[model samples]
Target: MTDAPGSEGPEPSEPPTSRREGGGLRRAHSAADASASTTTGARSARAEFETHVAHARAEFEEANERIKQRTGRDLILAIVIGVAIGVVVVASLIFFKWIFLLFAIAATSLGVFEFVRALRASGRRVDLIPQLLGGVVLMLSGYFVDLWLHWVLTMVVVVVLIVWRLLGQMFSRDGRTYGAVLSDVLITGLVVLYVPFLGSLAMILLSQDGGEWWALAFIIITVAADTGAYVTGLTIGRHPMAPRISPKKTWEGFGGAFVAALIAGVLLALYMLGLPWWTGLIIGAVILGTATIGDLGESMVKRDLGIKDMSSWLPGHGGVLDRLDSILPSATAALALFYLLSPLAVS
Candidate 1:
């Protein structure tokens, strides 16, 4: 037993080796020396462990400081650029219908470009020109025609791309690998769907009578959800929503998104889009679900390609795809709702 602090106790003493005349004295000295050695070693090891822990803590803090310094300017720049884009898009939708379509084409083209660049970075061979041409055609077709003709034009573009790929294979000996050619064809189709095909939905929405308001409502609800998630996640996020996919996203953030989206949906539906409050609530929920999936989908792509951002096109935004990740899937949902509950149907 050991003595308790503040209690009267004998001070521990080492048996003198010089008094090792008897067998009992020698044993006492040996036991004392052994105990003293063990205590010293344990203290030394504990000191070493604490030193290592302190060093690690300092390094972590330094890295965090560096990241904070770097992102400070980029964050401000990204916000400024984002606000400018929102104003331009809203203005175009209000005054110039043709300008809106042109903007969509440009954005769709850039989206295709970013996708091809990411594929190339991953050593995937993609025919850029054919995919680019196909994206433009897909957008123009959707903008000009009804839903039925839009599907026909989509098939026509796909067939043309198939022939275009075959012609390229015939011309280039090095591009004749069966696996590479197959990958190129599939990737071309994906680029179309991922960027232009889904993107054309925006044009479809805008072409309808009083469709600009519908388009604006969609944009506002989606943006609100994103903002809510980001702010909530940063403030109180603890449990990760998808740790393997997006470690930063949390269930708490999703809850925040749901609340914000619901409010935005109800208000926009009642005032802007001429729908009931209940309809807006449903739309908000749908958009939130689709937008979350879209963000995860892009994260999956980045994980597969072994790259951080698609490209450094936008400073803090990463790339066009990064910004459009939530928008594309939400756009598809919005388009479906428009068809089912056409705002123009009542009139």
Candidate 2:
């Protein structure tokens, strides 16, 4: 090696870093950095997607697990009985319209029996004969008369029940307390409105032009709402709707019920009822409130009376009242709403 100018051995070779080369190097660095960033981002996105899928699957399994835990043979039996009753009701309404009245009378009778018997079980003596008579008359009035007559006859039946109770109390030798008589009268009146009054609306509903289809649509929407409530309550129900009345009910279930009712109502109005879509929505909301309240109201009765169910009239279905709990208020609401919306529908 030869000595270089200004110092040590041969001069060290300088690195090739001209302006052009330096610019190319910078570009290469930028490209490499961009490629690396792209790869990292892609990996992160894939990981996130996988996490989301896992979470969704887990939630689904949890919901199913809850259903599995809550469902049993009793529920299955209830479904069977309900389906049979539903088929009978539909056939009656569609094929033999008059025959539907017989079914209504029978249902009202049974509902009255169950209601009064439950009160009796709670140590409250109810005059079953007068109550049954009044219930039958109340239900039949809907068949024979217009809506106004129906109401008028309902008042007539109420007065008849009260008079009958008062006469019986006067004739009875037993020292019946005034409180007991008052309780008897009050409960008897409630039964009149609760069972036959509401059940009679079905007859009124059948009096409409497309009443047959309207009845079916009402049943379908009610079932849908009830299903939504049952499923949602079983799966994710956390907040109690009325814990004292119905331990199984929940706000989440109500939400599910509302959504299901809304969807069913819209579809039925559009395709079946020939009404405006909003009509179904409003009717659905009405039915939802009334049906839920009816259910809770009955539950309150059972709770207050200290009974599990009205009776075991239908296996696994508790009683006629239990199965018809939602039907009563739903029928009334549907009939009233239909008449309100369509003046011509009123008979």
Candidate 1 residue spans exceeding 4 A from truth: 1-73, 175-177, 343-347
**Candidate 2 CA-lDDT value:** 0.82
lDDT per residue as tens, model 2, 254-285: 99999999899889887877777778788788
Model 1 Cα lDDT, one tens digit per residue, 55-97: 9989976865554463332545667888987888889888988
Tell me the deviation in Å of residue 73 in model 1. Answer: 9.1
Total clashes in model 2, counting residue pairs 3 or more apart in sequence or in different chains: 0
TM-scores vs. true structure, each candidate: 0.76, 0.76
Give the Cα lDDT of each candidate. 0.82, 0.82
Candidate 1 backbone collisions, by pair: none
Q: Which ten residues in a row have the lowest lDDT in candidate 2?
A: 64-73
